[model samples]
Target: MIIILLILSVIIGVFLGKYFGKSQSFAKNLLILSAGFLITVCVSEVFPEVYEAEDHNIGIWIIGGVLLQMILESLTKGFEHGHFHHHHEEKNILPIALMAGMFVHAFLEGIPLANITDVTSPYLLGIVFHNLPISFILGTFLLREKNNIFSWFIITLFALASPLGMVFGDYFNPEWQPYFLALVGGIFLHISSVIIFESNKNHKMDWQKLFLVIAGVGLALVNHLFHAHH
Candidate 1:
């Protein structure tokens, strides 16, 4: 069901990109909300889980994840955070590097999903919602490039990347779960922190955007509460 939801999000994003290309505000708000949600979940849920592990070296692993994402973004030009800038002349060329980076990032996010001993729904939900804007942004870029077959194929691959990651993650021995979770925590930290920090370029915080952040955090809190009572 999680795999199906992830794929469905990408499909929805592609559909929106094709038909609603002009809806930049919607896309922007979606990115903001999703980023906020991811950040909140990472702090309120994911980080605490990994930190509680017996391994004292988990912090180093999480930092490693952050640094890894930084390198990946160098190739992707920050695609995971909605940085889909492209030159008009270069638009004719496929963004092979960007796609490769996004695939690795997406695949790593699924590693923690395979060993969901506690409060895994938030992780799954966070990634699925997070992927929507990513797919939308990528879909818009691909459609603009005018390669119909290739665009569809790449989007399909992006949709499947997480599910494939889950399959691969299932093969890991249980002992390594903490390292993988901490790594994912770090990845989430970098992505979500970047999104929140870079959300406002004018240096003045937009009230609407702030609300989105609050709403995102509220969502994570609500989910935590709901699960805690049950």
Candidate 2:
């Protein structure tokens, strides 16, 4: 079931990428929605469980994951945004490196999803939903750069990274699960915060975008309520 969910997520990501690659506004809105949903998942769901587990030592893992992501992002110089227009010759090395970093993050996230006993459904749903927008944004960048084959390949690979993590998590003992969740939660928190901060309009406030964010949170809240009722 988990594997099937992951596969469905990848397919949905591909379809969303292909569909939204044309509209910058739609893409931006999708990203905002994804950011809100991800934040809710991390804060309302994942963090609570980690805290309940009483693993203060996991803070080290979270900090390490955040620092690792910072270093990786520094190497890419924000290429994940796909706005680079340098006349200097483009090399595939940096892009490949960025993908590797993302893959590591995604793979780690999958571990917790696989090990989840109580929160499995919502966690998996959040992951699948959140990944779709990321895939779309990355796809948009690739399309703009005119790298069709590489774009598809990277998107597909990103989709698979989580499931691979699940496989690892399934094989591993339960004792290490808290550390894994903390690490991935930290990474997700970092990524979602960056997206929200970057998406802020510097010159003026965008009410529509704000509303979209609220809508995203509302959706998650509603889902949470439904799950609770069930």
Candidate 3:
């Protein structure tokens, strides 16, 4: 069920981006909203879970995740954050580097999902929602470059990257679970924070964007509380 949802989200993202990627504002708004939810879940839930493990070197692993994302972004041109601009539409060939970056990032996201196995786990939710916009942008990029059967084959492979990570995640040493969680948490932080803080030039969010952010944070709180109670 979770694998289906994960694949469906990216497929849906491709559909939306192919048709509606021109509306950059909607994409940005989605990023803001998901960013709000993702960062909150990271701080309020995943971070706590990792720190509870009491690993002295955990902080460095998280930092490594952050750094890893930075490197991936260089390859993706910020596709993971839904920040792909309109200026690059002229190039009509598939970008292999972009696909590679998102593939690895998504793969890493799946690793921690296996550790904290839950249908409504924030880790899973974050990756699913977070992938939406990036996949959307990827679709848009495909639309601009090569909206061919071959392109969708690439998308299908990209869609499977996360679930594949989850499948392989079981092979990881059980003791290392917390470290993986912290690492993915850091990746979530960097992606979502860039979306929120860099959305506006002056860094001032309007009422609507502000509300989207608040709603996302509230969502994380509710999810956190529900898990706590159950």
> Which has the greatest lDDT?
3
RMSD of 2: 3.2
For each candidate, what is the lDDT?
A: 0.80, 0.69, 0.83
- What range of 10 consecutive residues in model 2 has the weakest lDDT sum? 79-88
TM-score of each: 0.91, 0.83, 0.93
Cα lDDT tens digits, model 2, 145-200, are: 56577777877778789888988888888877778777777776776677676655
RMSD of 3: 1.9
For residues 76-171, write the lDDT of model 1, one tens digit per residue.
777787666453245543468767888888898887777764434888888887988888887777775564887777788789888888889999
Name the candidate, 1 or 2, with the larger TM-score value.
Answer: 1
Which segments of model 1 are wrong by more than 4 Å?
Answer: 85-94, 117-120, 144-147, 199-201
- Tell me model 1's lDDT, rounded to 2 decimals: 0.80
Q: Clashing residue pairs in candidate 3, if any?
A: none
Q: Considering lDDT, which of the candidate structures 1 and 3 is the better prediction for this target?
A: 3
Q: Relative to the unseen true structure, what is the C-alpha lDDT of residue 137 in candidate 2, on a scale of 0 to 100?
A: 60
Write down the lDDT that model 2 would get: 0.69
Error of 1 at 160 (Å): 0.8
lDDT of 3 by residue, 1-230 (tens): 88988999999888898899888888888888899999998998889988999888899888998999999988877777775785365453236776788789888888876766678887788888887887887788776556888788778878999999888888988788889888888899899888777756576658887898998898888988888887
